[model samples]
Target: MPKNAKKKRTQNYKKQIGQVPGALIYTGAKEGNKLHLHVFDYNNEDYKEGDLDSVEEAFRFKDSETVTWFNLNGLNFVNEIETIGNHYKLHPLILEDIVNTSQRPKIDTYQDYIFIVLKMMYYDDSEKIISEQVSLVLGKNYVLTFQEAEGDVFNSVRQRIKTKKGRIRSEGADYLLYALIDAIVDHYYAIIETMGNKIEDLEDDLFTGLTQEEIAQQIQNLKREVLKIRRAIFPLREIINRLEKNENGLIKEKTTHFFRDVYDHVIQVTETLDIYREMIWSLMDMYMTTISNKMNEVMKVLTIIATIFIPLTFIAGIYGMNFANMPELQYKYGYYIVWIVMIVVLVGMLVYFKRKKWL
Candidate 1:
């Protein structure tokens, strides 16, 4: 089996293992996902941003009138995560999902707050797609975002909050949640656009005659990237749909429309992904056919050469026999005659093959 197929099998096997529900397990953070926090407290009149050194400091703003957005940059520090969870009265399962990092995009509503998990995707400088889990816990006057890494796709949302550029400053915590979710969904467009360009480049290479190995490797990589994006985006549609149709007062009526817009965008992304996947499958088939045709051409030439040599070999074998009286062997010019005959036969076969268009 292929490497990707083997990886898929291993992942599936891992998923099949049972884990205790609501168990607190800290799956270590990915590289660069250091422990850090960025707290944003804002209202219609005032906005404050702080880089926090401890999770305890974030608890002070939990009951404050100002809407606080605690952006935790990493989940590897189990103590800090547990401290914040205890302070906010988060459900054990909520903390579990936050630390697990492999949970699917989902939303779970509790008595006083809502918990959401999503995957944030972006392309690095090397044009490789990286996905990280982002969990949001929305409370009465606060929204806590847990990220797997220090960097995120939420920089635009952060800028808007700091600059007071949009309704983010004037809105409530739900709007901030919408802004963060919207930022993540919007980043999908950039990734899809990148994949589109890569598919086009691969198509160009395929037609312009890249080596079979190069084209095959590119097609496999492209397919894997597309599958990754699909896994991230497909479930998000249902999550956004649930948010849009939310009857809980946690999501305001006005903000549901924004969630609806995100739902539409997710649908668009999925459709585009399906198209790209089909193109990749077609490209793979085209590559295989091209390689097969090349092999057939090579075999045809070799076959023709072997056919021409068969008769010459037969004539040489007949004269090389140690017969008592071979007439051609007794002739003085027999060797020259045999050479002339062999040359004529070779030329005749070449001419025939040329006329038949099989040369």
Candidate 2:
């Protein structure tokens, strides 16, 4: 076909270049869950929980005295997120990060609030790891949490707040921040534990038999999963360090200790991730070694077969040649003698092989 005969591309492509900063570009799925604002306004005396009818209904909690948690699910609706940001007086960059699901775990301090982003990871029904970006904005008496999807690991924290099970009701918004993050960190244990089980299973599978091709892909997928965990959770250590030394006054002195506890959990998770990383890498080599050993056993049997046949084949070949002056042809019992000699040689070789344990 000539150059002009080719057809133009019909695929729809979204342009990403030359875009202005602070633009609300929802990079998540186009058909995600609708925007839901689950508001929790609670104090030491009373607790209220409900969903907002519209985005405008959440504006009243901006300056309320009670600690309010605005759990906003779904980032696909840029307009709704923009309205909430405008009402809260959040920075343009903060709004940008709210809808940008690719943002890494980080902490940014502002005059009146603190903006933090972290990954929330969990296993689906099929035991596959799924990571969602969660951006948290902590003010004096409110905490705004934005998620890419509806499901999260903060249900236990919500239960605690509703039942007044602990000091969450009496604490400030900083403590609420700690509680939510602690929930996320606590779930990390389950994720790592599941991965540990998988690694152990792979170890056993590789050791018990020659399964190079059988579980090769399994090891690969598990290795990728561990890397995802490392990327999702390791950067949290720096964020916690910032909270400990930050003098923004939004995080109370008592709350800093709680953050430190979460920091300790983060350290443990990262260390375990490091160990998993090494184990996953070694799994590939172990699989290859198993394959090599399998090949060696096969080659050893073949070599023994060839070694036993060499002398027998030589004797037969020598007798098979025809010549008029051959002395064996003139003997009366030459055929019987040759048969006995071959049988004796075969039995002797078999005995020697058995004694050497070559079988």
The best candidate in terms of lDDT: 2
Q: Ten residues in a row with the worst lDDT in model 2?
A: 9-18
Residue-level lDDT tens digits of model 1 in 1-359: 77556443324224325767776676643645578888999898888998998888888899899999998877777778888998899988899889887778889988789899988899999988888889998887899999877678888888888788978888889898998888998999999899999888888877886745777888899999999889988998878877777766888999898888888999999999999999999999988988888899999999999999999999899988969788888889999999999999999999999999998
TM-score of each: 0.90, 0.91
RMSD of each: 3.2, 5.1
Model 2: per-residue Cα lDDT over 150-212, one tens digit each: 789999999999999999999999999999999999989999999999999999998888495
The local distance difference test score of model 1 is 0.86
For candidate 1, which ten residues in a row score worst on lDDT? 7-16
RMSD of 2: 5.1
